[model samples]
Every structure is written in structure tokens, then in C-alpha cells.
Target: MLDHDTAPTGDKTIETAEDLSSIAFGFMASKALFAGLHVDLFSALADGPKTAEDLAKAIGVPLNRIVMLTTALASVGLLTIGDDKKIENSPAAQNFLSKQSKYDFGDYLRYQIDQQMYPFLLQLNAVMKDDLSEDAIASYKHWMTDEEQASVYSESQHAGSLGPGRTLARKVDLAKATSLLDVGGGTGAMTISLCKEYPELHATIIDFPNVAEIGWRFISEAGLVDRVRYIPGNAVEVQWPGNQDAILMSYLMSGVPGDDVEGLLRKAYEALAPGGRLMVHDFMVEEDRRGPALAALWQLQHMAFTPEARSLSVGWLTEAGRKIGFAIDDVDALIPAMTKLVVFSKPA
Candidate 1:
């Protein structure tokens, strides 16, 4: 009943009901954030504070929506409102969302927006109902052939591996390695990163032909053609080329179901020569597999090949490797939660 001008400044009417309603529409906030990132609003703010009018000119967001959008971001703490009403990046935003910072996480936002993740957001029920009937996988084939789609997914993984991968790669002596085969090696991030670090390393990227073409292009861009080769084919049906020292599977397992995974792992065991290694870098959940919520959630999303509903665990790999005649070694937890690097080796 109170008029805005006459009312006291406060969250006077907000209640749990209102909060619940907000939660329902929380997706609006996500879309707005995505749009802002797409327009480079955060990167723009990275330079310094800017008034609404100034932001409009710099980032090209609709002039009218600027204040509303900026205010929303500020309310969420991604930005700060200065004394003069100029807005700037919040500390969190600067460290993670700003493009200029190497620790920047702006790409995190972009990947969701640019990828088919948005439609899925609107159609999650359909997605949950075994409903890729409407061409759902067109944009989100967990094993996508499109270079850009795969790159988006892989870069998201890179961001996650950021703190951990760097430290581990530096600490681990992959220099003794001779060869590696990266299954479904989209754009070759793991292989490329490893090879770039170890001069003695050579790798073969195995994936669908269309996907391999993209990985090849990316490898050429990195100028590592001499060190890595792309072998395009399906991992399930094809016999993985053998006589390799190591095989790297990064974030590829969870996408596949258990029976399929067992088949692939069996193939991997056969593919390795005596004393060779199989590197399974993925979400290494706890033994009971109750915690690590994301990994648990991912198991549902990755309904491929009808994998056992039980999450993939370190214990699972260690035991499974022994069964396949490969001794598990170097199975350490990598920095990013839900990702572990387990080395399975054939007996000499």
C-alpha cells in the first residue's frame, strides 16, 4: 500500500513465496548474464567503472536494457556500484569473468550460451524423457562432430583442469612417455597440452572422421602435426591401434554407459602392449559414490550404452584394470573435483 517515494528504503515485501517465485524465474537471470557476456559487458567493465550510458556505448547492449541488466548483475555481485553510480567488476568477476585475466572464466558463460545448452534449458523435460526425438543431439551430441561444439565442451573442461592440470603436468614426469592414444580426442586439448610439455611424447587422436578433421585442424594450428596424428573412426566398433605406451581418456567415460564402457576398456586393455599405460582422466568419485554431486548428476545425463547407474569410481577402475590384466598406477585425484587421472598399465 505504500508509495515508493514515501516508503522506507528496504526489502519491505520480499518473502519466501517471492523467493520461490524468483527461483522459478532464475533462468531469466542466466539468460541475461549470457547475453551480457556475449555482448562483452563483463570484459568492458574489466577496464574500469562505467555509467549506464557509457556501458551502452561500449558494449552495444540495448541502451534501454543497460541499467536493468547492469543492476541485475550488480545485485548478483558480479559487479559493484560505486559512489558516483559507475559500475565495475566485482572482485570475483575480475578474477574469473574478465577476459584480460588468465584466470578468467568468461568463457564458462559463453559456452552455455553459444552451445545448444540454452534450448536444452528450455526443454530439459523433453531431454529427460529419452526425447532426442526432436533432433536434440543435433547441437549437443555428447560426442559431437562439429568442431565448434566439441571445442566449447573441451574448453569448459580446460577451464576446470586449469589449476589442477597445470600443477600435475608440471609435477608428473610424462617425459618418459613414448606414445598416447586419446579416444574421442576433441580438438586434442589433453593430448596437445601433454605433448607440448613433453618433447618425447607422440599421440594418435581417435574419433569420428568429421571430429578428427577438426582435431587435425586444431593440432595444425598448434603446429604439433609431427607429434600427433588423427585416426578417425568409431571407438566402440573399431579396434584401437596398438603398441602404444599410454592411452588418454579425458571426460570421455561418463558420456558412455557401463556396458559400453566395459567394452571400450576391454578394447583398451587389449590395445596396450606389455608395460604400456592407459590414462583414464575423468571424474573419480568416492568409493561409495554418494558424494560429488556433479558426477552423480552427470551419470544420469550420460545415459549412453546403458552404463550401470552406479557412478564411475576410482575403486571401480582399479579393480576393473586388474581384471583386464592392466595394473592400476598413478591413480591420483586431479585438481578439478570429479576428475581423476588413473594410469592402467599392462604387465611387462
Candidate 2:
């Protein structure tokens, strides 16, 4: 027992266990939201408040399940129980969770939670025991081999990337660059955003054939078909186009085998014109690899598929680029605390 008023501060100070508990039980909150989104519960609440019975009828779930779900959602701040005893979408849910909302991310969450990550995470123990061999689980490439799965994977990634894509567009200056090489650019989300920002720019996206088909559709829908083109191939082995003034590799590095990341950077270096800029944006851990909680978790998620998957560090990238003759230009968070953009320029 210690007196708080006279307790010695420093590292010896006792902290509440709530932080640990919160982390331990995080999946509950996640699954609650997943369940709500799964049946379009938020969409049903978009019009107005409804009794749990009404929600059950709307989504075809049991009344008692709806009652429990709405309660859990309210606990998670995604829903609210009004004095009238009706359940309603919280402002956050109405704006971003509802399927009718323009910023709806339900599909993204569905694809990530229901289709991909949730299943992968359940095998964490086995993955940790092995070296994350291919036998443990299917790699991203394996999943993408199926056309429908590729489309779903691409669209989900597009939804999540669009916001950060806009953020990156605002942060980087591309006014002078006329052409860009979007390596492993799925669905052309970033390229579409950037090209929209700079009307004079043109971009070529390189991805697997299935993914490129989906990307072409997205670019066409953006009315950027003429400015953005797709080239189908594995970026790691394909010959890069050398005429580009800028190259972007967003959310790509961590998926590359750890030993090959440098080789990939070297390829990007060789493909750039004099003074061309190269931007690598992905989830990166701290130099000491202690924690950026989500990024560390994501790195583990990557490990469940790829044997060599590991999060890159900003410090490592900066020094690696320097050795490859790329002058470091900027390193900034694109989606603060989750993803970072490391920019390097090839000297003339």
C-alpha cells in the first residue's frame, strides 16, 4: 500500500490495469462493430431511431440478439439509447458507419475483419511457432490469385487508402512532375487522388493482372482513364519504366520479404530519372521497435502470411536510401501514428 501524495514518481509508480485489460479485450469491441456492420444495422438506424424489435425485424436477427448488440454498440459509442428506449446511431456511426453515408467504411471493415484479418489472427500461436512458412497460411499473392478475391481485396484496400491518399496528396508537392510510376498500386486510389490534384500529371499503375483490372475500373470511374493506365505484372520482377519523374510505393514495403526490400529500393532508384522523387508509404515501427500499437499488430498480421514479413523502420529506410545515392527529402506521417511516407530523391 502506497500513499499517492508522497509516492515516489519515476518508473516505480503504479499504474491502473485498465490499459492492459483494454488491450486484452479489444477484440470484443471490434467484433461488436463487425456484427453491427455485417447486417447493415447502422444503415437501418440511418433514417431515425428504432426499437430493438424494429431493428431485429429489419435485419432478420433475433430480438434478444439485437438488444444485446445495440447495448454493446452503445457501450462502444457507435450507438445511443435514447430516453424513448429507441436505439439510434451515434453521430460517428451516422456519418461514417451508415452504408448510405458517402464516407462509409463498412465494406472496408467487412473485408478486413470478416474476410481476412480475423481468420489470420486466430492462427497467431501456430504462426509464432513456425517461421511463418507458406504452409501455415495462404500468402496475399495466393489469395489474389482468385479473380473475385482479388477484386474484393482491391476494393477494400481502395476504401481504406482513399482517405490517406487524399492526405498524402495534400502533404507532397507534385506540381512539377508530369509522370508517375505507381508500383504495386492497387485500385489506383492514391494515383487517382494525386492526379485529381495535379491535372497535368499522368500515372501508370503496376499490379497483378486481376488487381489491375479492378484498378482500371476504379480509374475509369474517377474519369481519369486517359491520365492513368494499368500495367499488369509482379512489381518485384517486372522491368520498371524509367521515364517517370516520380515513383510511389504505398503500402508495399512490408509485404516484400525483408531481404528483398533493399533490392526493391535499388530497382526504384535505377528506374528514376535524374532528380526524380521516390516515395515509400507504409506502416512502420519505431526505430527501437517498441510500439506504435496498431503498426506492431499489423506487422504481426503480415507475418501470418509471408515468411519474411516485418515492419520497416524510418531510420533504416533513410540510411538505406542514402547508400543507394538517394538524398532524403522528407519523412512524415501520412496517417499519424499508423502510416508514414518516406521520400527520397535521386540526385542528378
Candidate 3:
């Protein structure tokens, strides 16, 4: 009975049942996409269109089931039906989902979401209730203790980071920076990007030993062995090398225990020379703590592993940095709406 003037402000109303249904049924769509990636469906269709029967044979599914699978994918716009009624990948699927494409991120999606985050997300209710057992909580450090698990996680993370690293490199100006420190730098993605941009830059990455091993492979492949090196230790516990021109901490803040946040900031502060820039790129909730759904969900995901993980806000981080003698330089988006890069500079 409420008209526009009588409606509650800032309250969402269900205009149609479809909106609620879409939200409820969202998981099925995600699972369908994951199922497609599992069988390398996009890669099979990379060359051209194929008959459903051919896809069945290629993906080892029967014709009936293959049709159903393709139907699900097509409904989600990841696949399409041709004029000839053959199945094919859509433009987006062909570009980033196909294995033949250099921009392929299928493995990162499969490994991180399907294998890791999906499992943790199931425990979100338990996390919210604060009833998760100590044994049940598996932090990143615990996973790093197992070599195979660490390698699998780090490899996919490295793949995921490369594009963002390139994006960050484009966004931030590091033309004058020579010595750079990348704290908790997974596989040296940020370092590689920065070094590639500034040829005169030499960088050091600090991360877990297992992660450092994987990082070396990536650095070596990039052919920057001479300019980049890894200092293998926990970034919070290690003796960080000093007098850096810039320090980049991408995706580190939200992953650490709540108590360590300020200490880590202080460490970065002390480690930098006067006028050095410290860049923090992570998922930060809005100052009002309202829902920017993806960033909030990512912060919740961190709690699945690190139970003591704290949600960050730009206001809080800026205030914290100011308390440590850092002046705010800039705040900008790193991953569109999901992540932000906050730059702070130590006064000369």
C-alpha cells in the first residue's frame, strides 16, 4: 500500500519474486560454471562450435547429460547455441575461460574458489556464531606447513595475481623508486610488475619459505633473477631489509590476525626510509560499514581461515597510519569495486 513518498529510506523492497529467487539460486549457477571448468568444456569449444554429442565424447559425459550441462552454461551466458544448433563458448568464455587463451584464469577460479573458498564458505555460519573449533580453523600459515597444499594454493594465487599486478603497476607511479620491498608478496607478482615497469628497480619479496620457493620460479621465468630476490620468513616475524623506496603489501592486511595489523604497519613504517611510500591493497569495507557485497564477502572469507581476521575500513587504516607518522597520499581502486589501494607516505 506504500507509495514512493511513504516508502522507507535505504530499505530494499522485493519488486519481483525473481530477484529473491536469483539470489537463492545463485549457488547453482556458480556450481554449473565450476562443472564446466572441471571438464574443460570451454577449451573443447575453443577451436569452433561442436555438436552436443561431440562434447559428450570429448568431456566423457553422455549425450543427454552433456546437453543438460551445455544448457545450464548457455543459460548463464557462458556458452551459446549457433545457427547450426552447435554448442560454442560465448565471447567472454572464449577470451578468458578457454585454456588456449593466454588470458585464461580458469585455473585460478577452479583452484581458489572451487577447491578452497567453497569449502570454507560452508563454515561461514559457524564462523559467525564463533563456534568453530580450533582444530577446524586452518590459517594460511597452517596450509603453508604442508608443501603440496602450499604449492597448489600459491601457484593458483600467483596466476591470479599477475593480472592485478599489471593493473597496479599501471595505476601507481613508481618511476623514481629504485629499491622496493614487497611484504607478504606471493610469487612476486607485484614485484615483477613494478620491476618490469621500472627497469632500474631492484625488489625484495618476503613471504613463507614454501611461498618463496614458488615465487622464485615465477621470478626466474620472468628473467629478473638479477634484480629480484626473496627473503624467506614470516613477514611479521622476519627482520625486514631497510631503506626501501617503496613497500607494497597487496592482499596482506585482511589476511593477518587482528592484533598484528598495527605492528605490521609499524614494521613497514620503520623499514622504509624517510619519504618512502607504503601501498596497502586489500578488501576494505566502507567507512559506514554498509554492504559493498563482494568486498564484504571477501572479508568474511578471510575469517574462514584466520578466525582473528579483522575487517578493515579506509578511515581506520588512514587514522592508524597517521598515528605512526604516515601521511595519506592516495586512495584508489585496485580491482574495480572489490579491492582498494591506499597509499601512505612517511615524511622526509
Candidate 4:
């Protein structure tokens, strides 16, 4: 199974079977990961390593389940079991997934499993039916409303704990970045970070009306009302608000599928002033599909919805952006995180 997981495209039959296996066990893997995250297993291990028996007692999981979790984590390269049966985070885990790590993904996983996945599971049939159930509608509205804004803001801000956004944000000369556009910047996490970095930078945040109300309050509380404008509208039909020196695209593309993804990027490209950059931040896969367990698992989540829209490769993105006349530059794996940042620029 390990060999098969690492295999590239040599055997078509094996490749097809592996692909199916990945999809088949994808849910199981996701549940295991979320379970580990929920119980603070990674954080406990972060202080140092321990035996699964020790960990089981520490986290209060049964010994059987701890063994199962360890086996699954080891298979995914997120944990290592020594000869004496002590367990520790693999380098990947130490860097990106441990709750104590500065670049931790615990909050992001919590958001997905607790908020999005749980609710999405309940509304799956409705979503498939082209239906919007009243429960889902009410949950969404309530989530975005003023009363729950703090929870929304906390979740959104910490949700990027797994993002590659910080690296992309650093590579650019923000001094020249006067006007920026953050389309669908949930609760203004990315927006606030950029605003703080570039004193001259002003930003427009576009999100759902109720969500934008939360964002407005946040930008105001941060004393950035003068620098950030909240614009409430549907990202799908809204015209691209122009004159941005750079467009922040942090973790914003995966939820959009196929043509909509392309359309959104096209709009963003056109919205940029000449020489402006589109800072794409996401769990980008490697050129050759192999294990970067979190990213591979994330690809499954992407595929769960639209078959055509899986976690994309930065290499593929480069080629695609080139076709659109943008120059792809400074692609890098954001350390201490799961994703990669690929900065694409339109010529001056």
C-alpha cells in the first residue's frame, strides 16, 4: 500500500486502482485526522514523544483506538513509531499539523470538520437537489449575523492556520501596494494582516452581506475602518471592483468549481492594474502526485464536490496562467504549513 501510494503513473491498472483506493478510504483518513486534532493528541505529542499507551491515557481515548490512530497516522507519514513503540510527529506533522506549532492546522481542520463538514453532511442531499434547506439557510444566516460575529471572526482568522498566504504576502513590495482587493476574505483575516504590513495599503473586502457586516465591525475594531472598505455582494455575479495594486487570493478558490474558478480568476486578472500580482494561497499539490499527506487529503475534499475541481498543482497553474498572459513567479512551499504559494503577475 505504501509503495502503491508513492507510485507515479507507470501502471495504468494499478494507477486506477490506487486512485479508487484513495477515494474509498478518503473519508476514513479525514475522520482519523479530525479525531487526532480534536483530542489534542498532536499537541500533547508536540511537547515531546510518548508511547501510544501513554498517549491513550493522556487523551482519554481507548487503547484500541490509539493503536488504530497511530497506525493510520504513520501510514500517512504524520507520525513515526520507534522500535520501543514510542510515537512522535513526523517532520511534516511537527511543522504543520501540531496544535502547538506556530503554523498549526488544528483550527482549519476544526472549522472543516465541525462547522463545514458537519453541516454540509446534513445538507448534502439538499445541495445535490439544487436545494437550499431552511435549516442550512438559517444556520448560515445566523452564523454571519452580528450576534455570532465573534465566533465567525475567530474561526475565519484562525482558519488560515494551514494556509500558504503568509509567504506570498511577504514576497511582494507592499510599499507599492496602495489599493488591494480581497475577494471573499472571510471575516478579513488576510485583509487585516496585509493592512498592518503596508501602512499605505488600503483594501476592499467582498463577502456575503451578513458576513461583511462582521468584517466591517472587525476592520473597525482593529481601527482600520479608514483603510478597509466592506463591500457586500455575491462573488459570482459581482463585477470586479478595479484599481487594485495587488489581489489577495488566499484560500479562496477551492470552494469554486470549474468554469466558475476560471471566471473568478479572469475577473481578478482584469481587475489588477498593470504589473499587479495575484497572490494564490492554497494546498497546491506537487507536480508528480505523491504524499504530502495533508495536501493529498485536501485534494479528496476538493474532489468530494466537483469531480473536475480537485486540489490543483502549482505547475498546472503556471501553465494555465501563462495561457492567460500572466507570468508565474516565485512558487514556494510555505514552511510550517501544508500549502504552497504561487505568485502570478501580469506584465507592466
> Root-mean-square deviation of each candidate, in angstroms?
9.6, 5.8, 5.0, 6.6
Model 1: residue 267 alpha-carbon error in angstroms: 1.7
What TM-score does each of the candidates earn?
A: 0.80, 0.91, 0.92, 0.66
Candidate 4 residue pairs that clash:
none
Error of 4 at 154 (Å): 8.4
Is 1 or 4 the stronger prediction by TM-score?
A: 1
Greater TM-score among 3 and 4 belongs to 3
Off by over 4 Å in 3: 1-17
lDDT of 1 by residue, 1-348 (tens): 111121122324457987788867877777767877778888898888989999999987777899998888888777889889999988887877778988876676578444544544444455556554544452223446566666666556445445554555574566767888888676676777788788899999887665676568668877898999988777666668888777777766776555677777888888877877787777656665454554554554444222232368777777877887877667665644445677777898
Best by lDDT: 3
Per residue, candidate 4 scores C-alpha lDDT tens digits across 34-131 of 77887878887998889988999999999999998889988887789999999998877787678678778676766656556544455445555656
- Tens-place lDDT per residue, model 2, 1-348, is 111111111223335798778768988999999988888999999999999889899999999999998999899799999999999999989987898998888888988656877887867777667745554554566667888878878988898888888888998899999999999999999999999999999999999999998888889899997898888988887888886899999978887678778988999999898989999998877765665667677878777666567677788888899998999888877776677788899998
* Candidate 2 wrongly placed segments (more than 4 Å): 1-19, 131-138
Judging by TM-score against the true structure, name the best candidate: 3
Q: What is the Cα-based TM-score of model 4?
A: 0.66
Ranking by TM-score: 3, 2, 1, 4
Worst 10 residues of 4 by lDDT: 1-10
